[model samples]
Target chain A: MALDADATLGEAGEFGLISQLVAQLGEALTDDEHVLVGPGDDAAVLRVKHGHVVVSTDLMVEGRHFRRDWASAEDVGHRAAAQNLSDINAMGGTARHLTIGLAAPADLPVQWALDFARGFAQECASVGATVVGGDTTRADEIVIAVTVLGECTVSPVLRSGARPGDVLALTGRQGWAAGGLAVLGRGFRSPRVLVEAYRRPEPPYAAGKEAAEAGATSLIDVSDGLLAEAAHLAEASGVAIDVRRDAFDVPEPLVAVGAALGADPMQFILGGGDDHALLATFPDTASVPAGWQVVGEVRDGEGVTVDGSEYDGPTGWTHF
Target chain B: MALDADATLGEAGEFGLISQLVAQLGEALTDDEHVLVGPGDDAAVLRVKHGHVVVSTDLMVEGRHFRRDWASAEDVGHRAAAQNLSDINAMGGTARHLTIGLAAPADLPVQWALDFARGFAQECASVGATVVGGDTTRADEIVIAVTVLGECTVSPVLRSGARPGDVLALTGRQGWAAGGLAVLGRGFRSPRVLVEAYRRPEPPYAAGKEAAEAGATSLIDVSDGLLAEAAHLAEASGVAIDVRRDAFDVPEPLVAVGAALGADPMQFILGGGDDHALLATFPDTASVPAGWQVVGEVRDGEGVTVDGSEYDGPTGWTHF
Candidate 1:
């Protein structure tokens, strides 16, 4: 059972390696009612009062998902924590607990891990969530797998409820992150707005709950692009969406960045993403809440159109 | 926007890439009351009846998590699905939905991805769970990030409930996986049991639910080695645990493998892992279930001991 120091994981085998790793985690669950069983079981059981639970997950990887040179450990942690919690917000749930699985190279500084944890805790505190548990291990690169658990007192907002003729509204600006990326890639100094947008995405947390309360038909987050999300809404609701170009009030910083980068600001607004804006559809007569702007309308057509025509710039991102 | 076949994701940009990906996934949710809002906003919301929700996640990497050579695309999918669902069962919950995020090299054949989905679906049907949603992206290696959602009518079993004077019991065999792995590595073909154990782990699915109903004091799946899990139980319960070696009924297949490999069978029994057996501690007078066998006792000590002596075998897996 002795492990050879030079042995590779493949040589040692998967089951044995996993067992060894699980042994190192410190166990704290002990209250009779709090935890019915610990890590040795098939699944850990927990007790809840209201029975409603909220859940969201995000995955971060080394290099492709993040670059060590571009972001500090804390920034990476904050971004990772914020994005997942934002998903909970989209669900109209209040985040309460988180379980994180961190994979990093063994040579990574322990202090960096601590800093990441600190940043995660900071973001969690912002949303009144706690890091209840986590798993850590060594890998060729860093991968952070975070799952957030939330409690829902009310109904959660979903994507399939939009009806034809509903008004499409957005709460928060778009294109800033895309603009910021342009600045960063060109090694140009970013305007304040674009810089802040990239450093920490501001998800409209309160607005999501408000939209749910305001009888919104369907909702989604604009983590990708506005048109991209509109497509999701259209397909989900089995309706067409018509976005008016004149209705888009592009922020000045986005325009400035576009000018500097020789790109179109409208593309940033319509095709840009990572803004984490709450986009929801509501009845035309529904009272619009503060911070929400009407941008488009649901139509009888099947896909998303801009200004009565098909948008021909860029359709948006594709994972493949 | 029209995407050029020659364009890379970086050239398409993050926002553009996301939009294209989102456009392809059609809507799945339908009930008007079920979803207040759907994807497009900062988050999606769903209605939950008055029942506790269970959540669990697991991350699989290409080389480290699974070998494409060792396992078929279908086998990878099955293992990935099984591990996440097992976590829900550990929590005394029935899996209802799964969200998967797949990252792979673009050159990977599309058929592989499709077959993976088939494997995922087949596994989900086995446990009555469905693949609800997921994200897909390109990466250097194939990484599958799965988050499972479950519902429980009863209380969840947590790891913090073992009390002093509880009897430790296990509902399944151990060390067979490690033994099987050993056999596989040495190219021994005599023992089919060992090979099967390595291929598909058989966790005690129903036993977990039974133990919950029987009011087991504390429970954990023996994912790590037996002694390591005992340590977790002892630490979580804030008590010492003494595992009786004489009580352990090592399976004959495991013994044969050990004998063939010139390794100690006791080490494999006590330190081998991935059997996914349900282990629980209950009051001495409590009724033990059919598959469960009493193997240890809880006491006032602080750590785990085997037959009144500390075991010096492999301390379990370490990720880092």
Candidate 2:
């Protein structure tokens, strides 16, 4: 059952590559109590204890989402898992299972797929989730579709729940990914921190449930930067949001990178994406969790503003 | 919002295109009671009444799994939804929710994406499933990833439960897709039925629950040709399967196509795939459901055989 190191997907074949990838999941697939049936069947059966399952899907394409030259296969896999898992977190749910659908070239290295599985499994392990099933096919480029399932012990949080006078709070890394992208775009890789952030986002997985428990009015995954997602929250809730620019203390590394690249660090905090940070609104600052920092406020008007004004820069990315 | 019939996805923009596609879903997005939340949120919430979920995913690349020249976008979407919904049926579950992840070129016609959603929604509506959420992005070619979620009123069926002396039965169209593929390969399209079969497979969705209630031992989706999947069943159940070639009465279209192309209709019946037929092993002939046709038997040995011998031909497709 040992795979040859030099083998490609075409050389290993579909079932062969699948077996290797499944093997990479190891104990997560075999020992998960919530998995009634794992891979190899027509479908996977999962036990959802609370009767409510939170689910979401995300698509990541090579070159558009990531580059093999900039990040390893494992990094790509981890980022893929991280984004979907962040969606589950945004719903105030605990992620439980995932199903991946991958389309890659036949000449892709077998080890790359295996490493991707390893990284995906490791991320799932972090949140007590398991890779229940997947489908792999051949395409011209690598296209990954990830679907994550989670359980909500309480009523799941929604983006439309924010109310006027709510305090907006944030947790997890916010601008590091944008900084990394800038650094990568400029052909400088000295700042390993920002570069690693772009490669693998470390979302605040546990903070979501904590915010929900604290009776947060609304929650969202800040994947499209603070201002852009704030606009989404505002539109969904029919409320206005005012983000205080001075509230954010740019990390020393980001400041240094900004100085080196002649870019403003605050713009990254407000407009950069891929950090997968948790943005939630509480009744007041006192209700905000200890790890979360108060950075904005929900108001009666519409749209999002910086310091009560339209301070515009690059807001976020658009797929089309 | 009225979408311009001639507009491309890039011209329409991401949010604009998504809104149009969501509008295409119409009442299905708003009326489903099982969906506590739908698209436009970070994740969707589904109320699974049985506390158990049967889930599976499939990936379809434009050229690998389908061809735009041979089929319309609607056909491709229908096929994608069919393959995943058939998985839920194979597990003896009722499909309830679906999430689609799409990656296509930016210049793809807006109407094409809208038509794809319509076709997907139609297929889902037939089985009482709803498109709960999805992610759309850009890729060089069209790559679709579909995940289906279902609830099992009974214990979900698996492929490893068949015992010796089990009656192997089949339901739904077996080789029509293969016939259609053959017709298209040779640049002829007179037989509309066969060509349509390749475009949109009508899986016997309700028959799966019937088989489960009839005390079926094992079940599988015959998506990878009958013989190839029979081999899988045998390997999984630690038993052998023997197919009676005489049991198959090739349909008129297939027979005509076989004669027209100087091929054997039996080959299509035995080794053709993409029809999403249900292959199951019942404990006894008397236990087989009314709609099912007894085509084979599970024996005490290993591997699959046709009329007590190996009938050599193309078995099935391998992605790699």
Candidate 3:
């Protein structure tokens, strides 16, 4: 059944809704070269061109990850796919396929589920991924668990690989999602740019592969703010990082939105999470790819420093 | 820190709980040959020995799929993993790697979470599978989403490949889980075998590949009841399946449990679900693999028949 605007999921029924959504998603998300078996099977069959496969799973909760009042169903789907895809890409791999395990209240609108599949399918397709089989169940709140499978283009980079004297670099805008959240929290719906960033992230996927090919020592997606991620990299690699605040001197969309929210954009860049930007450390800064901008340098000690002093601002994100 | 008997997850904190549980599971679940990266990365990397991979995802919810009062934390984990692993096996593949997405109430005991991981880990190991990575989040009820990746031993079997005259066969017992559920529902905790059947299913994982090697025409795991699956096979293969109840005439645990409950065991066998038993069709009954019992025969028609007559029991299982 075609879901009306307000039709609840229970009214649509489980199998019928799955058939409708799967048929729609399968058409758009399938890559014949990568996918052997699609939905309506005991399991999905896929061809892994590379000998090794990269995989990641990320879960999003309705209230914890995204408030329904602040984000649309499409936004939730896209964000879920983006976060998982970004992690796979951060390992210097190309996105290949993905599956979703979704749970929502029976009273949820069926239209919301369809809209979710639409955005999720499109996002995976953008990364040349096929939608494999997944599970759906009933829940008190909407819980989306997405796992992405990716193919390696080069030797995978890990956080523990960074060495001393390596340059820390980033390839996408930071703090935009947090700024969008600020605007949304303030009840201003018109600052569509910030709100959009907060909803559907556009991570620099290709840059990760480029950095890996250029021999990046370590890499991570900036999902939990710059300083916080920097701290994780430092701890994992056993090296300190010196941040050059001047290197992030460019004035962009985040700076423009600062005045409207009455908040400092710089502070958001250093403290806010969910940007999903590609952050990496290169032994030679000159070898860093075109899109990546230098932000800091790996040092001998532990922890991170900003412009020759301690960065005591909000470090990273932690869920309770 | 070791969790006390009643220590809640929230008391352990998110990062701390993850660190402890992941440390525990990683020790038991990782194999160097199949897994390159384990729990501590953005995504885990695995070496797929087979050129192609078989993938399936299954999710279980608290109230709908299992109740904490009826099943222990370990049993829940094993059942969830068994469901996903069985799907991969049903495709004529060897289980290789798996990922989990877990959401639990903050007030849940940390010990319960650890036990769940332990059971989940052991079940995956039983099939020579390694745990890659997973996502853990907070929720009102415990939700487990398992995605299994398998390697094809022979050409994968499809549900639509059966032809007329193919003999339908099954490996492993049916209706045991339902029988177990019935026991649990009736508040009778004894009869450990019946309760165990409902909680931890032992699917004939090896038999799936064996059937394919012996030239089976079609295959599926009976997760949604035998009669329903028979109809599915018939519809998918464009043939009718005539089920022979007498073929399954031999006494087994299911029949033994029926007497205790004072219910028709045949109803559970035909209509009850969650057995994870391997059901397949071979071109010749004589060619059926060892341990497989012939249950029916395929013919030129649609739908399923019991002793050459239409079955009038419950058609199948559907999630709300």
The candidate maximizing TM-score is: 2
Q: How do the residues A1-320 of candidate 1 rate in per-residue lDDT, one tens digit apiece? A: 55443554445443444444333222222322433333444444445555555556666777755666666778777777877887777765677666666766666665466557667777777776655545555456777777776666667777778888899998876788777766877877569678667656777767777887888888887766889889988987889999889887778998888888888889988887777787889888456677788998988869999998999987565544
- Say which docking band candidate 3 falls in: medium
Clashes of 3: 0
Model 2, B82: alpha-carbon shift in Å?
0.9
Off by over 4 Å in 3: A1-6, A29-31, A250-253, A256-262, A308-310, B1-6, B28-30, B250-262
lDDT of all predictions: 0.69, 0.90, 0.84
| Alpha-carbon RMSD, each predicted model | 6.1, 1.1, 2.0
Query: What's the distance in Å from true for residue B110, model 1?
Result: 3.4
Among these predictions, the greatest DockQ belongs to 2
Model 3: DockQ vs. true structure? 0.77
Off-target runs (Cα >4 Å) in candidate 2 are none
The candidate with the higher lDDT, 1 or 2, is 2
Q: Best to worst by DockQ, what's the order?
A: 2, 3, 1
**Candidate 2 structure quality by residue, lDDT tens digits, A145-214:** 9999998998888999999999999999999999998899899885899999999999999999999999
Give the C-alpha lDDT of model 1.
0.69
